[model samples]
Target: MRLLLLFFTVVLGADESFITPQEYAAQLYHNPRGIGCHLCHGEHGEGKVIAHYIDKGEKKAFEGPPIRALDFRRFDAALNRRNTGMPKYFLTAPERKALYRYLHPETVKDAHAEK
Candidate 1:
Protein backbone atom coordinates (compact mmCIF):
# COMPACT_ATOMS: atom_id res chain seq x y z
CA MET A 1 0.00 0.00 0.00
CA ARG A 2 2.82 2.40 0.91
CA LEU A 3 4.67 1.62 -2.32
CA LEU A 4 1.54 2.25 -4.37
CA LEU A 5 0.93 5.56 -2.67
CA LEU A 6 4.54 6.60 -3.17
CA PHE A 7 4.38 5.70 -6.84
CA PHE A 8 1.24 7.79 -7.31
CA THR A 9 2.78 10.69 -5.41
CA VAL A 10 5.88 10.63 -7.58
CA VAL A 11 3.80 10.43 -10.74
CA LEU A 12 1.67 13.36 -9.57
CA GLY A 13 4.85 15.29 -8.63
CA ALA A 14 4.34 16.68 -5.12
CA ASP A 15 0.88 18.15 -5.68
CA GLU A 16 -0.08 21.06 -3.40
CA SER A 17 -3.49 21.69 -4.92
CA PHE A 18 -5.28 19.61 -2.32
CA ILE A 19 -7.09 22.50 -0.72
CA THR A 20 -10.87 22.59 -1.30
CA PRO A 21 -12.73 25.58 -2.63
CA GLN A 22 -14.02 26.50 0.81
CA GLU A 23 -10.52 26.19 2.28
CA TYR A 24 -9.03 28.34 -0.46
CA ALA A 25 -11.75 30.92 0.00
CA ALA A 26 -11.11 30.92 3.75
CA GLN A 27 -7.39 31.41 3.24
CA LEU A 28 -7.99 34.27 0.84
CA TYR A 29 -10.46 35.83 3.20
CA HIS A 30 -8.03 35.54 6.11
CA ASN A 31 -4.86 36.60 4.27
CA PRO A 32 -5.73 38.21 0.99
CA ARG A 33 -3.04 40.71 0.11
CA GLY A 34 -1.62 41.73 3.52
CA ILE A 35 -4.65 41.96 5.79
CA GLY A 36 -7.31 39.50 6.77
CA CYS A 37 -10.98 40.43 6.31
CA HIS A 38 -11.70 38.85 9.70
CA LEU A 39 -9.50 41.52 11.36
CA CYS A 40 -12.29 44.00 10.81
CA HIS A 41 -15.29 42.01 9.65
CA GLY A 42 -16.27 39.21 12.00
CA GLU A 43 -15.24 35.64 11.23
CA HIS A 44 -18.41 35.23 9.21
CA GLY A 45 -18.49 38.80 7.86
CA GLU A 46 -21.16 39.70 10.39
CA GLY A 47 -19.19 42.84 11.32
CA LYS A 48 -17.10 43.55 14.41
CA VAL A 49 -15.93 46.29 16.76
CA ILE A 50 -12.58 47.47 15.60
CA ALA A 51 -11.74 49.69 18.55
CA HIS A 52 -13.15 51.59 21.48
CA TYR A 53 -11.85 54.76 23.07
CA ILE A 54 -12.61 58.10 24.63
CA ASP A 55 -12.96 61.28 22.66
CA LYS A 56 -14.04 64.73 23.77
CA GLY A 57 -14.51 63.38 27.29
CA GLU A 58 -16.84 60.72 25.93
CA LYS A 59 -16.64 57.14 24.79
CA LYS A 60 -16.52 56.20 21.12
CA ALA A 61 -16.35 53.05 19.10
CA PHE A 62 -14.97 52.24 15.70
CA GLU A 63 -16.72 49.39 14.05
CA GLY A 64 -16.31 47.36 10.91
CA PRO A 65 -19.34 47.19 8.64
CA PRO A 66 -21.31 43.99 8.33
CA ILE A 67 -21.04 42.57 4.81
CA ARG A 68 -22.53 39.11 4.92
CA ALA A 69 -25.83 40.32 3.61
CA LEU A 70 -24.45 42.53 0.84
CA ASP A 71 -25.33 41.90 -2.75
CA PHE A 72 -22.67 41.12 -5.29
CA ARG A 73 -22.98 44.47 -7.04
CA ARG A 74 -22.53 46.45 -3.84
CA PHE A 75 -19.75 44.21 -2.69
CA ASP A 76 -17.93 44.62 -5.99
CA ALA A 77 -18.35 48.37 -5.96
CA ALA A 78 -17.13 48.66 -2.40
CA LEU A 79 -13.97 46.75 -3.16
CA ASN A 80 -13.27 48.47 -6.47
CA ARG A 81 -13.73 52.05 -5.42
CA ARG A 82 -11.69 54.26 -3.11
CA ASN A 83 -13.56 54.09 0.14
CA THR A 84 -13.08 56.39 3.10
CA GLY A 85 -12.11 53.84 5.75
CA MET A 86 -11.31 50.70 3.80
CA PRO A 87 -7.83 50.02 2.53
CA LYS A 88 -7.78 49.88 -1.25
CA TYR A 89 -7.04 46.40 -2.48
CA PHE A 90 -6.07 45.66 -6.07
CA LEU A 91 -7.72 42.31 -6.27
CA THR A 92 -8.61 40.82 -9.61
CA ALA A 93 -12.22 40.49 -10.71
CA PRO A 94 -12.26 36.82 -9.89
CA GLU A 95 -10.62 37.45 -6.55
CA ARG A 96 -13.20 40.04 -5.56
CA LYS A 97 -15.93 37.65 -6.65
CA ALA A 98 -14.35 34.94 -4.54
CA LEU A 99 -14.22 37.18 -1.49
CA TYR A 100 -17.83 38.15 -1.96
CA ARG A 101 -18.77 34.52 -2.23
CA TYR A 102 -16.80 33.77 0.91
CA LEU A 103 -18.65 36.47 2.75
CA HIS A 104 -21.96 34.91 1.78
CA PRO A 105 -21.74 31.18 1.69
CA GLU A 106 -25.40 30.22 1.61
CA THR A 107 -26.44 32.24 -1.41
CA VAL A 108 -23.22 31.37 -3.18
CA LYS A 109 -23.21 27.67 -2.65
CA ASP A 110 -20.97 26.41 -5.50
CA ALA A 111 -21.41 29.70 -7.32
CA HIS A 112 -17.73 30.53 -7.07
CA ALA A 113 -16.57 27.05 -6.37
CA GLU A 114 -13.00 26.53 -7.54
CA LYS A 115 -10.22 24.34 -6.32
Candidate 2:
Protein backbone atom coordinates (compact mmCIF):
# COMPACT_ATOMS: atom_id res chain seq x y z
CA MET A 1 0.00 0.00 0.00
CA ARG A 2 2.79 2.39 0.87
CA LEU A 3 4.56 1.58 -2.37
CA LEU A 4 1.41 2.31 -4.38
CA LEU A 5 0.92 5.59 -2.53
CA LEU A 6 4.50 6.64 -3.18
CA PHE A 7 4.22 5.79 -6.87
CA PHE A 8 1.03 7.83 -7.26
CA THR A 9 2.48 10.78 -5.43
CA VAL A 10 5.59 10.76 -7.57
CA VAL A 11 3.55 10.63 -10.75
CA LEU A 12 1.29 13.50 -9.67
CA GLY A 13 4.17 15.65 -8.53
CA ALA A 14 5.93 15.12 -11.83
CA ASP A 15 2.85 16.35 -13.70
CA GLU A 16 2.73 19.42 -11.48
CA SER A 17 6.04 20.63 -12.85
CA PHE A 18 4.44 21.18 -16.27
CA ILE A 19 1.08 22.52 -15.13
CA THR A 20 0.68 26.04 -13.83
CA PRO A 21 -0.99 26.73 -10.49
CA GLN A 22 -3.91 28.25 -12.39
CA GLU A 23 -4.42 25.04 -14.32
CA TYR A 24 -4.47 23.04 -11.13
CA ALA A 25 -6.88 25.46 -9.52
CA ALA A 26 -9.14 25.46 -12.58
CA GLN A 27 -9.44 21.70 -12.42
CA LEU A 28 -10.17 21.81 -8.70
CA TYR A 29 -12.76 24.54 -9.00
CA HIS A 30 -14.47 22.93 -11.98
CA ASN A 31 -14.28 19.32 -10.81
CA PRO A 32 -13.20 19.71 -7.17
CA ARG A 33 -12.87 16.42 -5.33
CA GLY A 34 -16.66 16.46 -5.29
CA ILE A 35 -19.16 19.29 -5.90
CA GLY A 36 -17.95 21.80 -8.48
CA CYS A 37 -17.66 25.47 -7.58
CA HIS A 38 -18.58 26.36 -11.16
CA LEU A 39 -22.06 24.95 -10.67
CA CYS A 40 -22.75 27.76 -8.22
CA HIS A 41 -20.05 30.32 -8.92
CA GLY A 42 -19.92 30.30 -12.74
CA GLU A 43 -16.84 29.85 -14.96
CA HIS A 44 -15.06 33.00 -13.74
CA GLY A 45 -16.14 33.09 -10.08
CA GLU A 46 -18.62 35.74 -11.09
CA GLY A 47 -21.46 33.94 -9.33
CA LYS A 48 -24.83 32.95 -10.76
CA VAL A 49 -28.50 32.88 -9.94
CA ILE A 50 -29.09 29.28 -8.97
CA ALA A 51 -32.84 29.23 -8.76
CA HIS A 52 -36.05 31.25 -8.48
CA TYR A 53 -38.69 30.28 -6.02
CA ILE A 54 -41.56 31.55 -3.94
CA ASP A 55 -40.86 32.24 -0.29
CA LYS A 56 -43.60 33.43 2.04
CA GLY A 57 -45.68 33.53 -1.14
CA GLU A 58 -43.25 36.05 -2.61
CA LYS A 59 -40.88 35.31 -5.45
CA LYS A 60 -37.26 35.08 -4.42
CA ALA A 61 -33.98 34.40 -6.11
CA PHE A 62 -31.16 32.23 -4.87
CA GLU A 63 -27.78 33.33 -6.10
CA GLY A 64 -24.13 32.74 -5.46
CA PRO A 65 -22.26 35.86 -4.34
CA PRO A 66 -19.36 37.13 -6.45
CA ILE A 67 -16.01 35.85 -5.25
CA ARG A 68 -13.46 37.08 -7.75
CA ALA A 69 -13.24 40.56 -6.29
CA LEU A 70 -12.90 39.52 -2.64
CA ASP A 71 -9.56 40.09 -0.92
CA PHE A 72 -7.64 36.97 -0.03
CA ARG A 73 -8.41 37.22 3.68
CA ARG A 74 -12.15 37.48 3.09
CA PHE A 75 -12.03 34.73 0.50
CA ASP A 76 -10.12 32.44 2.82
CA ALA A 77 -12.46 33.19 5.70
CA ALA A 78 -15.49 32.39 3.60
CA LEU A 79 -14.03 29.11 2.39
CA ASN A 80 -13.04 28.05 5.90
CA ARG A 81 -16.26 29.03 7.59
CA ARG A 82 -18.83 26.39 8.38
CA ASN A 83 -22.49 26.57 7.43
CA THR A 84 -21.66 28.24 4.16
CA GLY A 85 -24.45 27.86 1.62
CA MET A 86 -21.85 25.91 -0.34
CA PRO A 87 -20.45 22.58 0.77
CA LYS A 88 -17.30 22.47 2.87
CA TYR A 89 -14.21 21.58 0.87
CA PHE A 90 -11.68 21.68 3.72
CA LEU A 91 -9.11 22.68 1.11
CA THR A 92 -5.45 23.08 2.08
CA ALA A 93 -3.87 26.55 2.18
CA PRO A 94 -2.03 26.15 -1.10
CA GLU A 95 -5.18 24.91 -2.76
CA ARG A 96 -7.05 27.94 -1.50
CA LYS A 97 -4.33 30.26 -2.80
CA ALA A 98 -4.44 28.54 -6.16
CA LEU A 99 -8.18 29.08 -6.35
CA TYR A 100 -7.65 32.72 -5.56
CA ARG A 101 -5.10 32.91 -8.33
CA TYR A 102 -7.49 31.29 -10.80
CA LEU A 103 -10.07 33.90 -9.89
CA HIS A 104 -7.73 36.87 -10.18
CA PRO A 105 -4.94 35.91 -12.52
CA GLU A 106 -4.10 39.56 -13.31
CA THR A 107 -3.50 40.42 -9.68
CA VAL A 108 -1.36 37.37 -9.02
CA LYS A 109 2.35 37.17 -9.78
CA ASP A 110 3.47 35.30 -12.90
CA ALA A 111 1.60 32.04 -13.45
CA HIS A 112 3.29 30.33 -16.37
CA ALA A 113 0.80 28.62 -18.63
CA GLU A 114 1.81 25.14 -19.68
CA LYS A 115 2.69 25.17 -23.38
Candidate 3:
Protein backbone atom coordinates (compact mmCIF):
# COMPACT_ATOMS: atom_id res chain seq x y z
CA MET A 1 0.00 0.00 0.00
CA ARG A 2 2.78 2.43 0.87
CA LEU A 3 4.60 1.54 -2.35
CA LEU A 4 1.49 2.28 -4.41
CA LEU A 5 1.12 5.71 -2.84
CA LEU A 6 4.81 6.48 -3.44
CA PHE A 7 4.52 5.46 -7.10
CA PHE A 8 1.54 7.70 -7.72
CA THR A 9 3.20 10.63 -6.03
CA VAL A 10 6.29 10.19 -8.18
CA VAL A 11 4.21 10.08 -11.36
CA LEU A 12 2.28 13.20 -10.43
CA GLY A 13 5.47 15.04 -9.55
CA ALA A 14 6.93 14.23 -12.95
CA ASP A 15 3.88 15.60 -14.67
CA GLU A 16 4.21 19.01 -13.02
CA SER A 17 7.17 20.04 -15.19
CA PHE A 18 5.39 19.38 -18.46
CA ILE A 19 3.68 22.57 -19.58
CA THR A 20 0.67 22.62 -21.89
CA PRO A 21 0.91 24.11 -25.38
CA GLN A 22 -0.87 27.28 -24.33
CA GLU A 23 1.54 27.86 -21.48
CA TYR A 24 4.52 27.32 -23.73
CA ALA A 25 3.04 29.68 -26.30
CA ALA A 26 2.48 32.32 -23.66
CA GLN A 27 6.12 32.14 -22.67
CA LEU A 28 7.22 32.51 -26.28
CA TYR A 29 4.89 35.46 -26.82
CA HIS A 30 6.12 37.26 -23.74
CA ASN A 31 9.84 36.62 -24.20
CA PRO A 32 11.18 35.27 -27.42
CA ARG A 33 14.93 35.68 -27.51
CA GLY A 34 15.50 38.78 -25.36
CA ILE A 35 12.73 41.12 -26.43
CA GLY A 36 9.15 40.69 -25.36
CA CYS A 37 6.33 41.24 -27.87
CA HIS A 38 4.27 42.88 -25.16
CA LEU A 39 6.75 45.78 -25.05
CA CYS A 40 5.26 47.20 -28.23
CA HIS A 41 2.17 45.09 -28.72
CA GLY A 42 -0.32 45.14 -25.90
CA GLU A 43 -0.29 42.44 -23.20
CA HIS A 44 -2.74 40.40 -25.25
CA GLY A 45 -1.40 41.55 -28.65
CA GLU A 46 -4.26 44.05 -29.02
CA GLY A 47 -1.67 46.64 -30.13
CA LYS A 48 -0.56 49.77 -28.40
CA VAL A 49 0.66 53.29 -28.94
CA ILE A 50 4.29 52.93 -27.93
CA ALA A 51 5.05 56.58 -27.96
CA HIS A 52 3.90 60.05 -28.99
CA TYR A 53 6.29 62.41 -30.67
CA ILE A 54 6.48 65.67 -32.55
CA ASP A 55 7.90 64.90 -35.94
CA LYS A 56 8.78 68.31 -37.33
CA GLY A 57 6.01 69.61 -35.09
CA GLU A 58 3.48 67.41 -36.92
CA LYS A 59 2.60 65.37 -33.81
CA LYS A 60 2.87 61.68 -34.47
CA ALA A 61 1.94 58.56 -32.63
CA PHE A 62 4.21 55.56 -32.99
CA GLU A 63 2.00 52.60 -32.48
CA GLY A 64 2.10 48.85 -32.57
CA PRO A 65 -0.74 47.48 -34.63
CA PRO A 66 -3.16 44.93 -33.22
CA ILE A 67 -1.81 41.47 -34.03
CA ARG A 68 -4.41 39.34 -32.30
CA ALA A 69 -6.65 39.35 -35.36
CA LEU A 70 -4.03 38.42 -37.96
CA ASP A 71 -4.22 35.05 -39.65
CA PHE A 72 -1.30 32.67 -39.42
CA ARG A 73 -0.01 33.41 -42.91
CA ARG A 74 0.06 37.17 -42.41
CA PHE A 75 1.45 36.83 -38.92
CA ASP A 76 4.23 34.56 -40.11
CA ALA A 77 5.05 36.81 -43.03
CA ALA A 78 5.19 39.95 -40.93
CA LEU A 79 7.58 38.38 -38.47
CA ASN A 80 9.81 37.19 -41.26
CA ARG A 81 9.97 40.50 -43.09
CA ARG A 82 11.55 43.75 -42.05
CA ASN A 83 9.25 46.56 -40.98
CA THR A 84 10.07 50.26 -40.58
CA GLY A 85 10.29 50.29 -36.79
CA MET A 86 9.77 46.70 -35.77
CA PRO A 87 12.76 44.64 -34.76
CA LYS A 88 13.85 41.64 -36.76
CA TYR A 89 13.94 38.65 -34.48
CA PHE A 90 14.19 36.05 -37.23
CA LEU A 91 12.21 33.55 -35.22
CA THR A 92 12.00 29.90 -36.22
CA ALA A 93 8.84 28.31 -37.70
CA PRO A 94 7.77 26.65 -34.46
CA GLU A 95 8.34 29.86 -32.52
CA ARG A 96 6.18 31.76 -34.98
CA LYS A 97 3.45 29.14 -34.79
CA ALA A 98 3.49 29.25 -31.02
CA LEU A 99 3.17 33.02 -31.05
CA TYR A 100 0.21 32.80 -33.42
CA ARG A 101 -1.45 30.21 -31.24
CA TYR A 102 -0.99 32.42 -28.21
CA LEU A 103 -2.73 35.25 -29.99
CA HIS A 104 -5.56 33.15 -31.35
CA PRO A 105 -6.57 30.59 -28.78
CA GLU A 106 -9.89 29.86 -30.53
CA THR A 107 -8.08 28.33 -33.50
CA VAL A 108 -5.74 26.23 -31.42
CA LYS A 109 -5.85 22.51 -31.99
CA ASP A 110 -3.82 19.68 -30.63
CA ALA A 111 -0.50 19.80 -32.45
CA HIS A 112 -0.38 16.04 -32.56
CA ALA A 113 -3.90 15.94 -33.99
CA GLU A 114 -2.63 17.48 -37.21
CA LYS A 115 -0.35 14.55 -37.70
Candidate 4:
Protein backbone atom coordinates (compact mmCIF):
# COMPACT_ATOMS: atom_id res chain seq x y z
CA MET A 1 0.00 0.00 0.00
CA ARG A 2 2.79 2.41 0.88
CA LEU A 3 4.59 1.70 -2.38
CA LEU A 4 1.43 2.23 -4.33
CA LEU A 5 0.78 5.48 -2.56
CA LEU A 6 4.30 6.66 -3.31
CA PHE A 7 3.91 5.83 -6.98
CA PHE A 8 0.64 7.68 -7.14
CA THR A 9 2.15 10.69 -5.45
CA VAL A 10 5.05 10.76 -7.88
CA VAL A 11 2.80 10.41 -10.84
CA LEU A 12 0.31 13.03 -9.73
CA GLY A 13 3.08 15.38 -8.65
CA ALA A 14 4.33 15.45 -12.19
CA ASP A 15 1.20 17.22 -13.34
CA GLU A 16 1.73 20.80 -14.41
CA SER A 17 1.02 23.70 -12.09
CA PHE A 18 -0.73 26.84 -13.24
CA ILE A 19 1.14 30.07 -13.99
CA THR A 20 0.22 33.64 -14.84
CA PRO A 21 0.88 35.21 -18.23
CA GLN A 22 3.33 37.76 -16.94
CA GLU A 23 5.50 35.05 -15.50
CA TYR A 24 5.35 33.14 -18.73
CA ALA A 25 6.29 36.21 -20.72
CA ALA A 26 9.18 36.85 -18.37
CA GLN A 27 10.49 33.33 -18.88
CA LEU A 28 10.20 33.75 -22.63
CA TYR A 29 12.07 37.02 -22.45
CA HIS A 30 14.92 35.93 -20.22
CA ASN A 31 15.75 32.42 -21.29
CA PRO A 32 19.10 31.17 -20.01
CA ARG A 33 20.83 31.91 -23.32
CA GLY A 34 19.22 35.38 -23.45
CA ILE A 35 17.55 34.29 -26.67
CA GLY A 36 13.96 34.67 -25.66
CA CYS A 37 10.92 35.11 -27.87
CA HIS A 38 12.00 38.66 -28.64
CA LEU A 39 15.15 37.35 -30.29
CA CYS A 40 13.00 36.38 -33.26
CA HIS A 41 9.53 37.74 -32.56
CA GLY A 42 10.40 41.31 -31.62
CA GLU A 43 10.45 43.08 -28.25
CA HIS A 44 6.71 43.71 -28.21
CA GLY A 45 5.61 40.57 -30.01
CA GLU A 46 4.67 42.92 -32.85
CA GLY A 47 6.34 40.71 -35.53
CA LYS A 48 8.13 43.67 -37.10
CA VAL A 49 11.72 43.68 -38.40
CA ILE A 50 14.19 45.39 -40.69
CA ALA A 51 14.54 44.21 -44.28
CA HIS A 52 17.24 41.60 -44.70
CA TYR A 53 17.24 40.55 -48.32
CA ILE A 54 16.12 41.31 -51.85
CA ASP A 55 14.24 38.70 -53.82
CA LYS A 56 12.93 38.94 -57.37
CA GLY A 57 14.12 42.54 -57.54
CA GLU A 58 12.00 43.32 -54.49
CA LYS A 59 13.30 44.27 -51.07
CA LYS A 60 12.42 41.60 -48.55
CA ALA A 61 12.12 42.36 -44.86
CA PHE A 62 12.62 40.03 -41.93
CA GLU A 63 9.04 40.30 -40.73
CA GLY A 64 8.03 37.49 -38.46
CA PRO A 65 5.35 35.04 -39.51
CA PRO A 66 1.84 36.37 -39.88
CA ILE A 67 0.87 34.18 -36.99
CA ARG A 68 3.47 36.00 -34.94
CA ALA A 69 5.67 34.59 -32.17
CA LEU A 70 3.86 31.67 -30.65
CA ASP A 71 1.08 34.00 -29.58
CA PHE A 72 -0.01 32.20 -26.47
CA ARG A 73 -3.14 34.23 -26.85
CA ARG A 74 -4.00 31.92 -29.70
CA PHE A 75 -2.90 28.50 -28.57
CA ASP A 76 -5.01 26.62 -31.06
CA ALA A 77 -3.68 28.62 -33.99
CA ALA A 78 -0.10 28.29 -32.82
CA LEU A 79 -0.35 24.51 -32.57
CA ASN A 80 -1.86 24.13 -36.01
CA ARG A 81 1.25 25.02 -37.95
CA ARG A 82 2.55 21.98 -39.81
CA ASN A 83 5.97 23.18 -40.93
CA THR A 84 7.12 26.28 -39.13
CA GLY A 85 10.89 26.80 -39.05
CA MET A 86 10.86 26.80 -35.27
CA PRO A 87 12.95 24.01 -33.78
CA LYS A 88 11.32 20.69 -33.04
CA TYR A 89 12.04 21.51 -29.39
CA PHE A 90 12.33 17.83 -28.44
CA LEU A 91 10.59 18.78 -25.21
CA THR A 92 9.58 16.34 -22.52
CA ALA A 93 6.01 16.23 -21.26
CA PRO A 94 6.75 18.57 -18.37
CA GLU A 95 8.61 20.98 -20.59
CA ARG A 96 5.73 21.01 -23.03
CA LYS A 97 3.42 21.75 -20.14
CA ALA A 98 5.61 24.59 -19.03
CA LEU A 99 5.56 25.95 -22.56
CA TYR A 100 1.81 25.67 -22.64
CA ARG A 101 1.62 27.45 -19.36
CA TYR A 102 3.75 30.23 -20.75
CA LEU A 103 1.82 30.53 -23.95
CA HIS A 104 -1.71 30.16 -22.63
CA PRO A 105 -1.06 31.96 -19.44
CA GLU A 106 -3.89 32.24 -16.93
CA THR A 107 -3.29 35.91 -16.33
CA VAL A 108 -5.70 37.16 -18.94
CA LYS A 109 -8.47 35.71 -16.78
CA ASP A 110 -10.49 35.37 -19.95
CA ALA A 111 -10.48 31.77 -21.02
CA HIS A 112 -12.72 32.74 -23.90
CA ALA A 113 -10.64 35.59 -25.21
CA GLU A 114 -10.23 35.52 -28.98
CA LYS A 115 -6.86 35.44 -30.65
Local distance difference test, each candidate:
0.81, 0.84, 0.86, 0.50
Model 1 residue pairs with clashes: none
Q: Is candidate 1 or candidate 4 better by lDDT?
A: 1
lDDT of 1 by residue, 17-44 (tens): 6555666778899998967889988899
RMSD (CA, Å), each prediction: 3.9, 5.3, 4.5, 9.1
Which model scores highest in lDDT? 3
What TM value does model 2 have? 0.78
lDDT by residue (tens digit), candidate 3, 1-115: 9999999999998776566778888998888986799999999999999999999879999999999988789999999898888888978899898888888888766743431
Clashing pairs in 2: none
Predict model 2's lDDT versus the native: 0.84
TM-score of model 4 (CA atoms):
0.43
Q: 3 or 4: which has the higher lDDT?
A: 3
Q: 1 or 3: which has the higher lDDT?
A: 3
